[model samples]
Target chain A: METSAAGLEKAIKAIKIGLSLPEQDHLHRELEELLGWLEPLLAFNTGETEPLLFGHEAVNVLREDHPQEGRLAELQEAAPNFAGGFYLVPKIMD
Target chain B: MELRKTTVRQAADAVWKGEITAHQLIEKTLKNCSVLNEGLNIFTYLAGIDAVEQAKAVDQKIKNGEKPPLAGIPVAVKDDLCYGVLPTGLGSPAFSEFISPVTAAAVERLMEAGAVVIGKTNLDDMGQGSTTLSSPNGPTVNPWLAGRTAGSAGAAAVATGVCMLAVESDSGGALRQGASHCGVAGLRPTTGRVSRHGLNAHCSSFARVGITAFSGEDISEVLDLISGFDERDAATAVCREGISEIIKAPGSKDITIGYPVTAFDYLEPELREIFEQARERFAEGGYRIEEVDLGLLREGLLAYYVIAMAEAFSNHARFDGIRFGKTAEADSLEEMYEQSRAEILGREARRRSIFGAFLLSKDNYGRYYRQALKIWEMVRQEFETVFERCDLLMLPAARSLPRSLEGESGFLEGWSEDLYCAPVSLSGMPALTIPAGQVDQLPVGMQLVGPPFSEKMLLAVGSASGSTGK
Candidate 1:
């Protein structure tokens, strides 16, 4: 679900090239860490007296936890780009 | 009359008085839109069905003798801020083809108040630029001077005749500075002055949806209609409701005003002189003026760009190959991101992402982002401190005069001029820009920023200054 330093660097390098070098690995790593801490918080919220970021809101669970029917069939039927239950795309090389 | 030149209030009165039918208003409005929009490039998309349906409804209401606050008034909104009917793109090539499924709360409220939706306007690619030049379609030209900067020059030109009332959002000086350069009235109300639910995110801390109109009263009148608690937007502060009515302060007498001696140093010589004369004019009007020492905001644009861009890079991630915009054209999962990134981003959007990443990096966040935050805090503190000593603060709208087509502020220059205006916007204070008359036949506007949620107070002051004449 998350990237390590080398993996992030690889992704960053790839991203930079695709971005036409808008940024380099060094900058992405810095943003990655900050973003890792902030992704959930990047939205506007007012749960607190002051402006509450999305990350600050307490997570709530369903009052009555129960299994519901899944959208598996509908979701699967809609995927023209899928292969092996995953979205297919061109692979990149180092 | 087509009622094109009338203020929102004036147009609404004509409809209420049975002088103009809503359909006629819409017909004339579309004609104006087609005629004027070619040169200015203001609206991104005109809501043909929605506009007509809304107009027909307003006409029926009139037939029933019903009256609404914005009855039959045609208003235009910026593209990124959602209105439910049109495809909302924040000037990015990514979702340039996508339409919004839900309507923004702000748009919902304005429509409920009887405001006819004309269309969605243009903006900086990703709402990242201030001058409206960064748009992928083309910079929104000032209506008065062809090819003039809209955010900077269009603010005044829009007043001259682009749209009757324009809804422009501000992350930095996007509203007031544009309004200032355009020679119209722009107001960035305090945080929560209006709901940000349907707004495309820039930097939540620094961003706001502001209004532009010739009359300060029009901006505040619309502000009153849309400002309130929205159950959908958690950031919608419930502590304060909208200003009950525009404050009736005609002009200040014995009111102490702060003029930054040091900050004024940032002004180009011509801007400095124009500001000095406006300060003198205010003093002559029986108001007290004081030279408040605001530690000059040296690199505020850099700080603003870093802070806002970081927020945008993350916000824009949602457009990744799936939710909106173009899907990646690669064979595998990892390769998809690369292909999509190349196709989606514009020049400035890419530049903003790089700058945001660099400054928000661990090594630089403290040096750049945190330091910028500290400087901003200092500026806000100084504004508060000075306001305690003075009721209002006077300053110039921009650093240089209206830029010629040959002379653009460019990316760096554009980022820098926001220094003076960004502090006011970020602090979420009420800031207003009013024309101080043309200098060498080019317009120069002065700004009077006030305390939070005190737009009524600022509008009253700006109206007094603006009322002195063209």
Candidate 2:
């Protein structure tokens, strides 16, 4: 499938990214070339093969669920805006 | 001090025996790092006084009769790996001042083993590209040849002796290719062998914390210290079987190294010649070499990028400026996210994020994402079948020598450089790249890939046949 400007716009919206016209044009050409390069993947017959997610097949070890002290204060130090143990964000419902 | 000639074992031994104090070694290393950084741009951040203080503590520990395995050894950390004391830039300007609250498990283990961090090395934007040119801090110059890219700053640091070992991340062969470009040794351990708790996620399935050093011995030593099961990272559950037993170096005579003759066809003439010379060296050293067919090179490359991009999109979604990263001034939350991401991410990262969204879209999900996953399985199976006959697979580290810094290669052009390395990554096995030979005064590396949990065998073979290039 060819990557159209409309499709690119929809993708940009889906990812919540804002790009200028020039950036979009550059990305369009590059993404089209990359997608074209990936075309051979479609030719391979991968039938009967299971999709490998993680490289190793280790069963997840369950841990006892319990409340513990978190690094909220130290984490808040790296935040752009934090007050009263909460991260401050722009109003969404106003 | 001629730092280039020093090895991690020599430095650690000297410090342990009190032949040289940790402070003295650290001072020399800091001086070398400063002198080299100006010309080579090897470091994104240098520890300076902090490194000296850490070394002093190691010296005091030595006086107290405690012999740490990596006593007073200097290490260069790739910027992508979180080092709580320094900024974890991830190769973006927006993160130039962002400090991680927690240190990565790998780095913490290194420190506990007596490794002092010299500084954070440069990397590609968001660690997405093989070439280190996309970093906001400027390109890391090659130390071996003028006007050539280093491909990775960590490799250059090890090559220049600024650090004894460099802890770096490899998703699609950045560490291995960079080692090839800089004439050093790099080991990308089997996925989940090392904990990924503090690494800023790229491709969760393929990205692994790896080691780059002057010799396979150093890589092996550091690998043993860092590889273990971490409760914080569930992926590391694979290491519960004990890493020490799996890391014993075996004799070369006991190993059968396999080479894919068709894979060398993708390499340039000079690089192909270098690879042949490496195979001859191994054969001369009494190791058996055989021909193998890995027919899915091209398909593996495609599937790697598709899967990597899709996963990177999901991984980077959390960088929306509310809880982490620098926020952009906007009236609405959506605009804040869009503007912050646009300002924070570099061109290559943005391109990948957009492409990732497209690949994972409902219309293309099965056509691209799911198909790539299935191909990944096929690549893994091919390796499994090959390893049943051979103990290791030998391949070229990069398709060509380091590219010229004078010209910029396109995104697709950059992807071509990873042709040989990415397929091995899909196999989810450990691969070690060591300096095999040189062509036109530039170094070329050959990769020794092995089955999962076979790092010891790979490093032993690499050390036996590897060269430390001048």
Candidate 3:
């Protein structure tokens, strides 16, 4: 697929990340080259083949509903902002 | 006390027989690690008194008449695997101070079996590239040769004798390629064989907790200790019991080994010669070798990157800097998210994430992502057909020798390095990489791949082939 700087920027925006102008340009060029390498993937006829999402086939094992002790204090210590037993985030509204 | 020449079996036996206490062994290992770390840069964090205390516990267990299989063996963990006690840097500056609340299940099992964790080793930025140069802790120098990349820090730690085994993760070919470069044995176990609990996910489907050791016997022993079902990781439901019995069943000369002739075309001349010698050794060892075709090897490489990157993009969504990692200061919520990820993630991490977003976008999802998945199915089917005729497949672990530290490799060039190992990964099979021989004084490795849950058979064959040890 063809890629452009604007299209690439839009994709990056969806992921909630920002890059400098030069970095964006470099990413676009690299993506274009990488996509070219993937061109051979289109040569095969996969109309009848189903997509394999995982490497192995396994049924998900479920556990009984139960509450367990949580490591809230230790988890909070690694966070950048936390207070009053809650994670702190920048305010979205005034 | 020469760690380089010591095997895990010998060390554990010595400890069990009272020849050496676990505490004394750990003390000697710590001293060796300190001296080696200054020059090799293999460890990012070295355990201190805590390691000694753990070893003492093992000694107490022996006093009580309990014999642990991995007694007094020192192991190193890749930084990406969470250990709770040591800060898991994930090869990024943003996470240099972040610590996991829980340890990885694989590492926990090793400790339970009497293996002491020496430290956390370095890696590529979030395990993106094969070369460990992108780590914030600086690159791990190759132990075999100076001014060369170790490919992965876990391999270097094992090769340098800082640790007897290394718990590492491999999404594509990082573990195998690193072992090839450092001249050691690395095993990427069958998907779902080992638990992924507490591991920082990069590519959920392909990413697996693997092991690197000095010999195939060590790898087999450790695999038995760690491979089993864990309710925490649903994927491990596929793992069955009796793995110990299977791995210890003894190597059989009646098994058939499949050889992919066309795949050798990708190897450099000198490396190809080494692989040929390994093939001859296998044949001389009494195993029947048969030629097989793997037409989708190159196509599998393409599909691997597409699926791996897309999964990585989804997994990395958790690293928003709010729950973990250092958050960048910004005026608004949107800017906070943007600035934090932009500043925290390295170039390769960001580049792959952005490309992943593009491939999975609505416009390109069917054109690229869906097509790659279909090709992935074909690749798996191809391997399944080949395995029907042969019990094992032998291939080169790497296409070329480790590149020099002074040279800068382009992104494509780096990706091409995975040409040989990625296809086996895409098949979701178990592969064991052992030191075949050396070229120009640099070690080369050959991998033996088997069907899913065939790790035991692979290790048995690998040990018997006489390709292990530098």
Per-model DockQ against the true two-chain complex: 0.11, 0.72, 0.72
Number of the top-ranking candidate, with lDDT as the measure: 2
Q: Each candidate: what lDDT?
A: 0.66, 0.87, 0.85
lDDT of 1 at B119: 83
lDDT of 2 by residue, B280-391 (tens): 8778888888899989888998899999898888888877887777889988888999999888778878888888998888778998999999999999999999999888
Interface RMSD of each: 9.3, 1.8, 1.8
- Per-candidate fnat, comma-separated: 0.09, 0.83, 0.82
The 10-residue segment of model 1 chain B with minimum total lDDT is B239-248
Where does candidate 2 chain B have its weakest 10-residue lDDT segment? B243-252
Number of the candidate with higher lDDT, 1 or 2: 2
Task: Kindly indicate the candidate among 1 and 2 with the higher DockQ.
Answer: 2
Alpha-carbon TM-score of each model against the true structure: 0.83, 0.97, 0.96
Q: Stretches of candidate 1 above 4 Å error?
A: A1-17, A21-94, B2-5, B152-157, B160-162, B240-248, B407-410, B467-470
By TM-score rank, best first, the candidates go 2, 3, 1
lDDT of 3 at B243: 37
**Candidate 3 structure lDDT:** 0.85
Give the clashing pairs for model 2.
Answer: none
Q: Tens digit of lDDT per residue, candidate 3, span B129-161? A: 788877777788899898988998899989888
- The sequence of per-residue lDDT tens digits that candidate 2 reaches over residues A1-94 is 5446666777888778778888888888876787678888887899899998767776787788998898988899999889997889888786
lDDT of 1 by residue, B105-200 (tens): 777887888888888887887877777777888787765466467673235335655356667677777777777666778877667667777788
Stronger candidate by lDDT (1 vs 3): 3
